[model samples]
Target: MGNAIHDNDSQMLYLKKRLNMFLEVLESVDPESTNLDDIDRMIEMVDDLEVKVHQFKKSE
Candidate 1:
């Protein structure tokens, strides 16, 4: 049980890091100056991270 909890916590931390990185990237980009493809890719990455986080929570 302890190991499971630890694993969950680690996964949560990783997810948070990914989210922060995405946010930084998004913030660094100027909406008017950035291309649509880059914005789409960032959005997709965030979506994927969210799905992973949800899966981790469900497993716990």
Candidate 2:
């Protein structure tokens, strides 16, 4: 049980880190010349991370 809890915590931390990185990338993109493809990819990554976080919570 302790291991499971620890693993869950680690997963949450990783998700948060990934989300922050994605946000940073999004912020770095210039509004006047942002690539739609890059935005789409980042959005997908955020969605994927969200799903993983949700799954981790459910498992807990």
Best by TM-score: 1
Cα RMSD of predicted structure 1:
4.8
lDDT of 1 by residue, 8-49 (tens): 668877778888988889789887889989979988988898
Clash count in backbone of candidate 2: 0
What lDDT tens digits, residue by residue, belong to model 2 across residues 1-60?
134434766887777788888888888888888788987988898898888778787877
Screening candidate 2 with a backbone cut-off below 3 angstroms (N, C-alpha, C), the clashing residue pairs are none
Task: For model 1, name the residue pairs that clash.
Answer: none
lDDT of each: 0.79, 0.78
lDDT score at residue 16, model 1, on the 0-100 scale: 80
Please identify model 1 stretches exceeding 4 Å from their true place. Answer: 1-6
Evaluated against the true structure, the overall lDDT of model 1 is 0.79
